[model samples]
Target: MLQILNEEGEVVNEKAMPDLSDDELKELMRRMVYTRIWDQRALSLNRQGRLGFYAPVAGQEASMLASEFAMEDEDWLLPSYRDIPQLVFHGLPLTKAFLYSRGHFMGGQIPEGVNALMPQIIIAAQCTQCAGIALGLKKRGKKNVAFTYFGDGATSQGDFYEGLNFAGAYQAPAVFISQNNRFAISVPVEKQTASKTLAQKSVAAGIRGIQVDGMDPLAVYAATKEARENAVNGEGPTLIETLTYRYGPHTTAGDDPTRYRTEELDNEWEKKDPLIRFRKFLENKGLWSKEEEEKTVEQAKDDIKAALKEADNTPKQKVTDLIKIMSETLPYNLQEQLEEYTEKESK
Candidate 1:
């Protein structure tokens, strides 16, 4: 239960604050603002059929930003599809992100030195992959750690247990971050697990586990930074359960929450929005002004609009190109089939 800011956004743990310069804090706030704007715009795009399905990180901005900021450049990140903000914070281009949303195959081909994996849609798959990567790094005597992100529901999958157990047993350099947003597609966390907390589950796997206040960015950063340090220092893996909430649907094209949840509860969560909480924290420090806040949000909106336009202008991919991209050396039978298809098309 680590926390820096309380529910009212007052500094409750001054010692936990990062040694950040005013410029850095301002920049972080800018990124948060931009990320929120991008998320909303993407959701709108999906609704308008301009893009494919999207997972909104509307209520979890602090959790994403802090965890991302805690990582090193050389470290690897295995993120679930919902972690768009984490990818953006790690220097992924906005154009590529939009391209991915538009269903482009090459959009996820991350550039070198980025050390981020493609977003995994299969639940809990990236956890095992991260464990393997961390194990390999450990064998190679590398200092880098691997951080894998997943939701609360993913913990029920076999891969989650297998990955965590193996990482602990072999002393793999990895961190497992469980962003417990309470609902796994309408299934509450309590119904998903009998355990009192997700972090407690890690104890059975023989790893250090901590439950952090996810809405508090500084708390998340402190927890992840410590976990990362322990991994790099040969102390093996750690599990961090970030208690947070999602204020939107599971994905843009998913079922409406009103079918399963109360609008009153939704409104309550809205009042506890991480962005607003952090904004108040900054204001209390005299680090944010009303005019500056307006200007920041306006700039973010402009940037997002520009990025969306760029995504729209990009050349559309041909449906036939999928087959061409799939094979390097086509078998004789496949070659004959392709030739027959091409001949029929020419007719």
Candidate 2:
């Protein structure tokens, strides 16, 4: 495992820093702040019954943003449900993300100019998709690559190995990020698999694998940037195991984590919070301060408020339209079903 930064706001290795400028560093902090605010808003919206399903990323900003910021705009991203923050940074609009939480059809569609697929809902299903897409990009001789995110739990799924095997066999330009937040919903990571480290799983496939301190954004960024460089250089895929945690319920469906986790455990991870560590690092460099953080928070609040109003203004999807968009030409059964539903609803 590689740990460039420690828990107490100190850098352990200044020599292994990633190629990020001071402006970029400040931007990263701003993004993490904005993303944390957005996470809170989404959770509140879910509680108020104003939004549908949501996966909070409150405590995983460093893990998510650092790796995501490492990618170029042209690179591919295959995200999971909890990865909406990275997706937004990669070109997804905040409003669309809000719409996604509302379960609106438009929210699921990949808008123009974005190179990401809809966040995978079926766990590791995106792994194979990442492999398949990477193969296509390789065959086309494109410099771009594809990377996907899954949790420690997804490593146990069949698709996870299959994707790794396929990419390794052909040396496809792909990257796999396993956000080891220590739990796959109710199941703790210890019970999920026998592997001592998730990154070593890539060894079996003959690809590179590395572990990083997910709480330290700089380490994650450096690892991801190196993985991407290696992959695009035709060295094939790399698997990154990010050691982080989720601060709240896995989803807003009322899964009380206390059933399987202890409050002591949460408090322990709290001591190593990503935001505080990064803020300390930046402040030491004269790149950030408490006053700047407050201003950023206020700006984020206004921006989120405007986004909420925009999402509210967006028209709701009708059942008839939903069924019609199911296909270019609705199949006979679907057409019948659509007509029946439309007629029933008209009454």
**Which candidate has the top score in lDDT?**
2
Per-residue error (Å), model 2, residue 257: 1.3
lDDT of each: 0.85, 0.92
- Tell me the number of clashing residue pairs for each predicted model: 0, 0
After superposition on all CA atoms, what RMSD does each candidate show versus the true structure? 2.0, 1.2
As a TM-score, model 2 comes out at 0.97
- Least accurate stretch of 10 residues (summed lDDT) in model 2? 1-10
Off by over 4 Å in 2: 344-347
> Can you list the residue pairs that collide in candidate 2?
none
> For this target, which candidate reaches the highest TM-score against the unseen true structure?
2
Note the residue pairs that clash in candidate 1: none
Give me the overall lDDT of model 2.
0.92
Candidate 2 colliding pairs, count: 0
lDDT of 1 at 9: 84
Angstrom error at residue 253, model 2: 0.7
Task: State the displacement of the C-alpha of residue 152, model 1, in Å, after optimal TM-score superposition.
Answer: 0.6
Query: What is candidate 1's TM-score against the reference?
Result: 0.93
TM-score for each model: 0.93, 0.97
The whole-model C-alpha lDDT of candidate 1 against the native structure comes to 0.85
